[model samples]
Structures are given as C-alpha cells and as structure tokens.
Target: MRLLAELRRRNVFRAGLAWLALGWLLIIVANLLFPLLGLPERAVRNLALALLALWPLVLWLSWRYELTAQGLRRDAGAGAANPVSRRTARRLDQLTVALVLMALALSGLRHFVLDRAEPRGEAATGRALPVGEAAVDSERPPAVPADPRSLAVLAFANLSPDPSNAYLAEGIAEEILNVLARIDGLRVASRTSSFALRAQSHSAREIGRQLGVAHVLDGSLRRQDDRVRVSVQLIDAATDQPLWSDSFDRELTDIFALQEEIAQAVADALAEPLGVQTVRVRRATDDLEAYSLYLRGRQLFTQRGASLEPARSLLEQSVQRDPQFAEAWAALAATLYVMPSYYPDAAQTSFEQADDASARALDLLPDLAEALAVRSRIAADAGRRDEARALLERALTLEPNNANSRMWLGLTHLEAGHVDAAAEAFAESHRLDPLSGIHVGWLGATELIHGELAGAREHLERGHALGWRGPASAWLLKLALHGSDAEETARRFQDWLRDDGRIPEAVRAVHHAVAPAITDPAQRPAALATLRQAVEQQPGYDWTTLMLFAGLTDAAIEEALRPKPASGQILLMMIWSPVDADFRAHPRFAEIAQRHGLPAYWAEHGAPDGCQWHGSPDPRLECGQ
Candidate 1:
C-alpha cells in the first residue's frame, strides 16, 4: 500500500500513459508521412523500434523528474498531499487524453478519407488527364472474368537420345500453341509463361491456377535418325485428370503434318466447350533443316542478351536455307532491330537489314502478323509514328491474341505519348504473357514514369526476379536513390553491379563510374567525364539515363539529341515521363522535340497527354510540371 501510494505521488502511472500516447501519435504520423516523402519502409520500421527502445528511458525520466511551473526538476519525493505533485498528475491525464484523441482522429482520417481518395497501381499510373480536361472520377472498371477456355501448353519433355534436340520438342509445343492462338475464341497462355512454369516443374493444376487456364497440354518427343515419336496428354487443370491422350510415330519430314494433326485434335476436344470453330496451322517452311535452325534461333532470341548474336547467326542461316519462310524472315527482322539496343554500332546496318527482311517476309506472306509487327517496330525507330501505328493496328487485327504484337503496339503508343493507350496495351500484353520479363519490366517502367511508385516497385522486382536485367535494373536503382537514404541505395546498386554478369563489361564499367554521381553531387565532375568517355567508347548503350540520374539534365538532353541509328524509343519515353520533368521544362526542350519530329507528330495527333503547343509570336512546347 505504501509503495503504490509513493508511485502515485510521483505521478508514474499518469506520466507513463502520456508518454505511450505521444509515442503512438509519432508512429502514426511517421506511417503517413514516410511513403509520401518517398522514404523506405525501413525508415518507419526503424522509427518504431527506436520509440520502443526509448520507452524505458522515458519511464526512467518520468520517475526521476517532476514537471513544475519552473520546468522539469529532480523529484523531491513529494507525497500525493503535495499540491505540485497533484497538479502535475492532473496535467499528465489531460495530455494523455489529448494525444489519444489526436491519434484516433488521424487514424480515422487515414482510413476513411486518404485510403479512399488515394490512387493505386494502374489507376494512378495509367494516364494523366490532358491539360484543361475536367478531373473525372479515377475509379477503374471492374475486372473481366477469366476466360474458362484458356489453355497452357507446357514445354514438351525431350525423350530423344541426344538431349541437344530439346529445342525440337519446345519448338513443336510452341507451334501448337501458335496454331491454337489463331482460333477465334480460344485463349492460349503465351510460350514464355507456359514454358517458364514447365521449367519450374509446376504441376498442371498449379500451372492452370497461376496462368488462369482451364486446361494444360503436356507432351514428350523422341527423335532418332529420320524418324520421330510424339506422345501428348491434355489435362483438366482443375482436377488434373487426363481429358485426351494421343501418340504419333512419323518420318521427320512429316513433322508439320504431325503438328497440324495434334493441334486439330486438341481443338476438336475443346471445340464444343470453347466454341472454337477452326484451327489453321500455317507452315512457315517445308525445309526440315531450316525449320530446326529457326527453332534454335528463336529459343536463343527469347533468352536475349549474350545469346542474341548467336540467335542472329542461326536465323540468318535459316533464312538462307528457306528464303520463302515468312516466319523466319520476320524473326530475323526482329533480331536485327533489337541489336542496336545492345550493340549500338550496328544500328544503321541492322535497321537497314531489318527493313529488308521485314519487307521480304511481307512479300512472302502479306498477311503474316509477325512481319507486320516487326515492320512496325522498324518504322517506329525511323520516326514514322503514324506508319508504325497503322502497321501495329493491322497486325493486332489479324492476330488479336499476339502478345508480341501487343507489346509493340504498347511501345508505339508510349512513343506517341499516349500514356493511357500504352498502359492498356502493356497490361493486356502482361495478361497474355505473364512470365515475359521484358513485358513486365516495360509495364513497371511505365508505372514508374506515371508516379505509381508502389506498383512500379512490385512489377520491377518481379521482372528482375524473372531475369529481366535491362531498363528494370536502372529504373529500380532510380527508385532506390529517390528513397530517404540515397547513399545507402547507391552503395547497394554498386554492390549489385559488381556481381551482375548480364550487362556487358564496358557498359558495366560506365555504370559503376556514373552510379556515384546519382547520390553524391561531389562526384559529378569526375563521373560526367567518365560517362562522356564511355559514350564515345560504347555507342550502343543509353547514356542519357545515366546523365539524368546524376542530375546532369543538360548533358542528358545533349546526349539524347545526338544522332544515333538505334530507335530512340527509350530516350523518348524517358523524356516524356514525369521523372524528366526538369528536362522537359528546359528552354532547349522545344528544339529537341522539333528535331525528333515530335512537333510534327503532335501537330497531326494533337498535343500529348500532359503537353500543349503555344503558337503565334513565341512558338514553344509546354508540359505540365
């Protein structure tokens, strides 16, 4: 009874409550402020931990000190009878009540107001309203229900004695997938997602659930001498039960016929349920060797990076063997078109070759969707925006389910500054090919530019995890530097760059030199010199992003203006995105836009999402800040 009375006299209970209330309020405020300020989650977590650690100190101080009119004074062991002690206790109670009420009100404000009003993910990043447009409701439409007729074609197992023939099995499965995709109502999971899941050894049920597919096709192929054997099973993904099974033994020369037979059988099995009417299997080439080479090249092409050169070589051989192969020609065109992005010196030659090849493919098969899409990309790089868009539209109309065409369309839209259209195209491409790291990475990059930080982070991390190392890495590093502790983020990126083997050695060196300037203004001079030297030594890599990250806006603009054979798609996207607001606001930006032909394109298409054209005495372009 004496101990309790003494503690009360010192107002320990009242002081402890007040301290806790104050700590709670601080935590709530930190939670609300940190993300808005672009601070990392770790900042909030550390704040909470620091408050916890301070609890004991606060309690000790409360016990040892007394609040008086004269200010905090050492406790003089006054009993409850002392008017000062009683008064202090009453004041502590009032403070605690006020803190609690404030915390409650803030919590309510966050839950009922902020949460409801704040934009999220796609809605936030999809598009910014045009200047002077009324602010409409930002709510997204309800999601469409998943198609029940969807199917995922898993990579076929290679049962051949020579495991090197694995590409044959994969090629066959992809051909079937392509054939099924052409069916009007049939939804087929893309090769990237299906094959990736197969590589991970996911079961039919899991693959179906993850891919939003109702059916799964699994198969194995064995090839010996001039003969081949294929066995396939179609499973009900929901129950993992075999819906259909088949086996075929045929001469290697009959491979196309076999593929057609298999595709027709699968389509027939699902025709009644899916309302699929026809399955048209188009043969790109009759030459077995050419087909084999094309398949191998395509496999390498999909891997990207270090494999691109080999893919190009193999694809070139495929075309030589079968000059009339429209599909192979289109694939070759795409390979050549992307070479400049990885090897800039080849830009002019590659673009010329790509244009010729795409034209050849179109000549061979005028309706080939792949040829149309690849040609569109070539046109987009050449500053023929309207032509590119027309080509993409035609390709999409012919093959509505073509993820590659969709991705190209998205890029075209982005280049035109049609953010909403680009976002829709990218989202649809992602839905059609969820496991494609490039698609996911591009979507995330778009989100980043649109200011959807959380969505960008989520998709970028996922893309990186799936082995996309291009723009995703740079964008993620940019996000990290934008965080509360930029130095720490830069250090971490430097550490990652040291170990990453995907980037070329020369490009990696430049990245290392410039990365420091992103966070440390003192390093800018040395970093800029190194970066400029790198631009000369390596003509293929994008140095503009590096300059932007380093806060050398003028340098970035100059680099962007330099004539390069590579499609300046990335540069255009970076400049138009909100991240480069300062770059766009520069007085010289109008000149850059005119040089890049954006002014003409905009004049025909109207001003871009956030930009406007001012005519008359002072002709200039203005973008929203």
Candidate 2:
C-alpha cells in the first residue's frame, strides 16, 4: 500500500493513464485520416504498433524521472527528499488530467460529430459529395438485403517475398469467389466492388456493412518455392465474429483442390448444401505459368479501355503457352470484341480475330458461359438480333449472376425494341454489379429511354461518382437538356468537351455554341447549322444525338439512315434513342426499316413494341408506314 502511495506521489500512474488515452486517440485519428492521405492500411497498422511499443518506455521514464527546482533528474532515494515537491506533483497531476480529458474529447468528437456528418444513401440518390462513395456512409448500415446468404470475398494479401506472386494470390481468391458465385441462393459481391476496398483500413465488420453482405471471407497467401501457404477466415459482418477459419499448406499442383475445399467450407457454413453438378471446378490447365499469365490478362481485360491491347497480348501469350485453356480463349475473344471501340483503326481485324477466338472456345467447351457471352456480343454487333438473344439467354441460364451476359442481353432486347425487357435486364445487371460505373451508366441510359427523368438522373450521377465519366457525362447532359435546363445542359456539354480529348477542338467549339440553343426554339436554325457542320467533320453518335435534341428530327434521321463508316454505332443509337418519336412517325421511316433489314429481323425475332407487321402487301412494319 505504501509503495502504491509512493508511486502515486511520483504521478507515474497518472502519466501512464494519460499516455494510454492519448495513444488511443492518435490511433483513432490515424485510422480515419490515413486513407484520405492515400496511405496504405499497413501504414496505419505500423503506426499503432509503434505507439504501443512507446507506451512501456514512457511509463518506465515516468517511474524513474522527476521534475525539481534543480532541473529534471532521476528519482531520489525513498528516504531522501522527494525530488518532486508537493506543489510540483500536484501541478503535474493536473497537467496529466488535462491531457487525458483532451484526448477523450477528441475521440468523442471524431466518433459522434465528424463521422455522423459524413454522407449516406448516395448510391440510390446520387447527391454530390467531396469524397468517394465509401465516405457517403461512415457509420450507417450497409444496403444489404435480408437474404442472410450474402457474402463478399475480399482480395487476398500477398505474403510472398517476391511480391510478383500477387497474381497467384488474387487468382486463388477470385477462383474461390467464382465458385461461390456459381452456387444458387448465394448473393456474392462482384469481384471489382470487393477488391476496390482492399486498400482501405476498414475492419471486417465495416467491410461487411458497406458491402451489405452478412459474411466476409478475407485471407492471405504466401508462396515459397514449390509450396504455398494459404489462410482464410469467414466472419459474421454484424458481430465481427469468425464463423470459420482454416490454413492450408500444399504444393502448387493441389491449388485447385484447396480452392474447392475453401469454397465448400464457406457454403456449408452458410447451411447451403452444394449440388454435385453445381461444383464445376474444372482445372483450366496444368501449367501454372500459363494460369498466372491468364490471371494477369483477366485483370487487364476488366480495365475495359486503353488496357485492351496489353490485355490481348497477355491472353495470347497464355493461350500460346497452354493451347487447351478454353477460359483464356474466351477472355481473348471478349477483349478483341471490345477492342475496335478503343482502337478504331483496327476495327475490321479486331472483329475477325474476336470471331475466330470465340468460335474456337465454343468448339472446345460447347456450353462455356463466357464463350457464349462473347459470341452473343459479336452477333449483337452484327445486327443478328435473334442469334444474339438466344446465345445471351443460354449464357445467363448457365450463370445467372453473370453481369456481362445480362448487360449484353439488355442490349439485344433494346435492339429488338422490347424496351420493358431491356429495362429489366439492365436492372438485374446493375444489381449484380452495383459498383460498376459502366453498368450503372447503362442502367441510367435505360431509365432515360423509359422516360424516368428523375430516376435516370439519380443513376447517372451515381455512375459518375463511381468513375464512369464518359458515358455518365453524355447521359446527364441529355437528362438536363430533356428537362429544358439549358444552363445545366450547356455546363455539362462544355465539361465533356474539356475532358474528352478525342473530340476535335472544332467539334468542341461547335457543341459549345449548339448546347444553349437546344432549349430555345428561336435558336433552332443556328443549332441546326452548327450540328450540320459538326456532322460533316465527324459523323458520329454525339453529333447525331445533338441534332435530335435540338429538334432537327429530319436531319437526325437522315444522318442515322445514311450509309456511313460508323453504321454499327448508328444502329445502336437508333435502338436506344428514346426521343425518336418524331423519326418513328415520319413517312420515310420505311427507309430505315428497309435499309437495316428490320423486316427480316422482326420475322426471325418478334417485332419491337412500336412496330407491328401485317403479312399482306407489306411484310415490313414501320410505326409510321
């Protein structure tokens, strides 16, 4: 008791208490700030560890040192004059108390004031904010459904010394995620959304809440020589409690078995029994190097724009290394199919290569969902509406959660003029991959065509927030112009011109002048003249769309019906354009029907809602004719 009293007299306990409080506050602040400052989660953890190591040193120093009239020095002997005078000790205690109170106050402010002030519900509403969507709700619950089967598999950590083995770790985690996604009754988060949060310093519970998943599977991998060590844990997001965990050390050849075991364990824990046929864990190839190269290619392909060329190169290398890898072929085909849009100079060759690769993949695996989806996209581009729809439907039947298939299916429905069906397919695609900007942007476009102006704006803004700048900007400008908000429309158009480098300066200047004229009937002649000039310079969708928006219906239809280099894109524009009422009602609409082979298209498939055929004198059906 006397020793305790002596320790109190020296204010050692008070100092330790204050240090602990301050350390806790520092950690809380660091966790909140590090991500904003672009620091990695590892940096925050290292900061915490460093602070912890300093705690004992601080306590020991407090125990041995004392402030005195003579200056700072070691504590005197117990019997000797207490080096710290009574008044000095009291002042020191008061100072420590102040420090503790300050730390507590800061912590409270951070938790209650700062965190609560963060944004929320932006996914559905699309309110403007300074930070990313993750900040929109710092403390609110995630938007998960009550299914209880929802899961998010986070990116696995690369613990290997080489660091280049990151592809292997990600491949393992992605394979497991794919397996889980294939199982029915499971609501798995998309790989893009799940992996996007890998850098944030969020806990398992926070990740679960944000992703709206009841459970989270997070793990790490360490590759050494011929063996690999993998560790994974499944946690209940609500309580932050681990439901299951396991570690595996196995040779590289056994990696597929390990992934299946992990996937099965997760399914079993959720009380969902895996069906025999549902487990399609076929090994892609025995060549690990080829598999690694394929994973790299897959990652690049998901980037979706400028990365297409490099992605194509990697996939080609992978297939060359392992000619039997059907997945690689499918992925290569998908890449080439989209490459023409990015690299227009090679458009003809790109489609041919895509066709060959997709055909080869289908030949190798007749029912491969990925291969079917790629072929479906090619058919859709070729104006083969029936074939595209059938292929996409089959692909979706094989993999119901395939967002890409759903997106393409939506496009095919739009092409066939089934607006309602197209809307449903786009909605499903958006739900399956809510964080994907392109998907959400397309959903917004569908909503716009359906004449849901407010709904379209909400989704377009959300898509912009999610990093789909190009498509979202175009759609949002349309929304503004559709509502007759001339200022907003012009603002968006000018911004687009500034950001889209591919648009020629002359084109941008013409659009800038034409934007404000869209809202005023008096300026129609000037806008039409500007649009005509722009179309002459670049006969494309944007120019065509501007003409339609500016009330030059005849000119717009003429540009669309004209035989041109971008006829494929023009056909798509005609399919998705919601404001084509005038064009649809024009007497010469039959020209479009005839030029595009719409009569045969409708006969092979059903006609879209607006057009109906009577078998007599005219097999062709036009809403106007």
Candidate 3:
C-alpha cells in the first residue's frame, strides 16, 4: 500500500503508467481495426508518430519535477515532503519504462515471428573450394581444411583427332565454366588456365591439389563440323568423388541452348548438400547461326591482333543475323571496346558500333551479366570505377563467375592499393580456373604488392611452367625485387628467360641484364634496337620486346594494356596501370595522368561525374580516361 501510494503520488510514475496504457490501447486498436484503413502500415506509422511526440513532453515535465528523500518539488516553488529519494530507484523505474515499451513494440511486429524453415543452400555439400586455395594449399590445408567458397573449371580434354575444330570442344567447356561461375557463392577459374590444361593429363586429385580447389571439373569435347559433343564430370578433389556428370550433343546452332541446359543441370546437381541458391532461365536464340558466330568471335577475341577485324566482321554478321541476340551484341561490344583500350590505332569506327550494340543488348535484358560486364569495362576505361563497380556488382550478382569483370575489378582495387581485395578477386578467378596464366600472374603480382616475394615467386613459377613465359610475370617478380644484383638477376634471368620455352641465348642476355634498367634516352633507343632485333630472329615474339615496351613511361602504355593485341605484337608489354609503390609519390604520375587525358585526380574516388576511377586518382600510369 505504501509503494502503490508513492507511485500514484509521483507524477513521473503516473505519466509512465498513462503512456504504457495509451500505447497498449493504440496497438490493440490498430491490430483489430488496421484492416479497415486503406494503408495499415501508414496507420501504424501515424500512431507511432503520435507516441513519439510524448517523449519530449515527459522529459520537459520531469526536469521541472524533482522527488527528494523528504519531499516532492514542483515548479510552483513549494518544496513539500512526499516520497523517497533513492536515485537507484528512480533510475530503475526509467529503465523499466523503456524496456516495457520496447518489448510491446517488438511483440507487435508480424514478420519477426519466423515459423517457416530457413532455406538450406548448397553450402551443405556440393560447394567447390576456391582456386587461390592452391596457394594456401602450397602451405598445406589446415589440420581440418574447411570447404572452399569458390571453384574453377580446368581444361576439358579434346577427344577428337581433328585439332582444327578444337575451338568447338573447348567452347562447350568454356560455356559450362561460365555458367557455374554465374552462381552467387561460386567462383569459376579463368579461361587462360582452363585452356592451358588442355595439354595435360593430370589426375583429378593432382589437379585439384595444385589448383587448391576442393572440386575439379574434367571432361572431353568432340566435334563433327556442325555437330558438337561434350562430356563434363564434376569431382570432389578432397575425397576424389564424382559429384555429377553430363554429356551434350547439339548442332552448331543449338550450342547455346545446349550449354545452358548443361549449366542448369550441373548447378542442380551441385546445389543440394553444397546449398547454393540459383535461378536458371533458358531463353532461346532466334538465330542459331548468329549465336555460333558470337562463340567464334569470343575465341578470336582471345587470340586478338589482326584477327580482330575478322572477329568484328563475324560479330557484326551475328547481330545482323539476330538483332535480338543479347549475347552476340554483348560480345560485339566487348570486342569493339578492346581496340581503343588495346589498339588505339584500330579504326575508331568500330567503337561507335560497339557502343550502339551494347545499348541494344541492355534494352533486351537489363540484368544480363554479359552486357553489364562490358558496360563496366567501358565505364572503367573512361575513369569511372564507382559506376564500373556498381555495374560489375550487378553483373557479379547476375553471374558470379565473369573473369573479365573480376580481373578489371581486381585491377581497380590493386591500383588503389587494396592488395588483399585484389588478391581475393584474382584468387576467385583462379579458383574457377587454376590453369589460367592470367589469373596466376595477377595473383603473383597482388602478393608482390605486399612484398610477399616467396608467394609471388611460387605463383610466377607455376605460371611460367604452365607456359606463361619467363619475362611474363614470373621473370618480372623474381628479377624486379631482386634488384640489380647482377649475379642473382642474371641467374634468374638465364634460368627462366634463357630459352623461354625456346629463344636464342646471346639475344636474351642483353634484355635480362642491361636493357631493363637503362631509362636514359641513349640507353632506351639502344634497348629498343636489341628488342626489335630479337623479335626478328625469334620464331614467336618473346617477352623481351614486350618488357622493354612495358617499361616506357608513355601514354601508349594506356592503349597497350587493352585486351586483344595484334597477333604478332610483343606479348611482354601489356599496358594499362601499374601498382608499383615506388612510383606512387613520383611527380611524373601527374604528367602521365595529364597525357592520358585523365582528370586532375583520375584515380581518386568520390566524384560527381559518371567516371570515378575506383573513386580516386592513382599515382601510377594514369587512369587511361
């Protein structure tokens, strides 16, 4: 009776009780009468708004009313004795008031009651480990290795004797790899690695071990001209168990449809225990011939050089044959962008066509991964990393396994010195395709960014031994960090580049030792002379000429970094941006930016314009804007 009298006498207590009563009354009324309101949610909101208005009123009133050990004081100025003045009791009352109100609000929310069983995705079993797991595996799997978050599709062997039609078989395998990569929680290996493994006959265990993938895909392809045949078998490398397998037979025109069918099937088979959520849709290609041309264009796009002209011609034919072909249009746009980004000298007219084709592709399917990835590249090259990332994120969401998007995004991160992210994206690309020299090279470089010389050397060695070339990434990483230590640099240079799978020894020495460091006008000209001479003597253009060209602090490097180089051009000198920490503080980076037509802060992020190079201006080879 004493406590009840005290509570009633206190205005704060009285007000708290009144608010609680009012709040309950409002909720009960709303729940019972909400359906009558056109917007029940709004009705509830209005009630909440009304209640919110009471908080300040309480605070203001409470400030003027104070309770003491002997008295209750009101603003009226008469300090009259009324109740206890236990500060702890007052604090407990306030907390209790808040907790009760919060509990009431939470209990009323309908969605919070989750009675439905949560979806258990493929994470339960069929998940494949990422490719960069290979590097971690290089250190050996932990005592109990955890399952991987990604996977790579290695080389699917060619069963046919007609090597001329090798493209047909590999194309099917590539499509499957692309499909698996598209799933949200899955990472497919790079095309370079998958293609390189075509020559090898490694067991699933060995291949999986080397790739650091928990799962490995192995199969064979055969083609009878217009008729194509494919077989794909998915295996769990950790236990060497065959998870799923499928075979496809289709005419050249029906290849796209067939590829999708295989992809959908494999995804289903891999979904259960592994628990990945996926949505598969098969939209028919009205023009089968046009689709075939798109596939052919993709193959040529990889080879690049003078052949891209024919590729564009073929891609144009494909779109003309089927104007609604989103894949063909996307492929066309991708090839078209390669020129300015790679061969700025290529007729600029193709870019106009590519631009138009990309727009058309998006019109057909706004969420198309291929179209989005191509657009992202266009945005990135134009110095819009934010827009590019937004597009690439959508592309990744639509199709998680796009090598081009992954590489570009990874490179963008690398340029910003986000070494770990770059490594992760590259690792995913590698996980989806272990045999790719490109993925290995990028991974090696990412590791070297943090000066992980050993990791870089290991990946570089794997890349070189897999046919990436010495002056490729392996040679640069090993020699660049080794500095001008003549003996060590010479030994590494000789051991790796002395033959580069096969080239002249006397010619290779000059590039390995002297040509690399000579940046002076006199030395550069002489170095170029030797490189040009070496290119002439060699059957295939080696990495030496490319390396010399790469060292040039020229605007031309921006254009050179673009994919689809001239067939016989120097393979060593890939242009684009550099991630070297040394040049980060150099003043020349500004000049390089100005030369490439980049903004004042090209690589810097957070811009109002559409182009935001990873959202910031990099201090290296400019943003190539």
Q: What's the true lDDT of residue 527 in model 3?
A: 58
How many clashes in candidate 3?
A: 41
Poorest 10 consecutive residues by lDDT, candidate 3: 115-124
Cα TM-score of candidate 1: 0.72
TM-score of every model versus the real structure:
0.72, 0.72, 0.56
Looking at candidate 1, what is the lDDT of residue 494? Answer: 73
Give lDDT for model 3. Answer: 0.55
Root-mean-square deviation of Cα positions for candidate 3 versus the true structure, in angstroms: 22.6
Q: Model 3, 1-625: lDDT tens per residue?
A: 8646544445556456556656665665564344322222345667877886886677456446665545545634224553343563565467667757765665454223210110100101111222222222233433444346445565455556575555555566777777676676655556655444333434455545655556667666667767766666676766555677655667766766776777676667768645766545455376767766777787777665455677789888988988888877887888887654334444346556666778889998788787888787666555565676788888877776666677766765554445577789888776555555567777876665555777877877666554455434434534453464545544554455543433444455655544344323355555555555554565232343334333433322322343342222222112222433223323454443443334433445432122223313443332212
* Residue 101's lDDT in candidate 2: 77
How high a TM-score does candidate 2 get? Answer: 0.72
Ranking by lDDT: 1, 2, 3
Tens digit per residue, CA lDDT, model 2, 377-449: 7776666666877898998887887777887888777766777888888888776666666677778887887
- Tens digit of per-residue lDDT, candidate 1, span 1-625: 9878777888888877887899889988986775444344466678888888887888788779888899998886743345588788889899999999999999888666554443110011121111111122112322553466788997787767897888888888888888888877888888877777676555566677777788988877778888887777787877666687667888988888888899888988887777646655666678999999999998777766667899999999999999999899988988888777666666678889989999999999998888899888877766778788899999988888788789889887777677778888989888887767667877987887778889988888777666665566766776776576877678657745753443567587678768777788899998889988888987666677768878898888888877665643677765555656788777777777676566677788887777787754666777776
**lDDT of every predicted structure (CA atoms):** 0.76, 0.71, 0.55
Model 3 earns a TM-score of 0.56
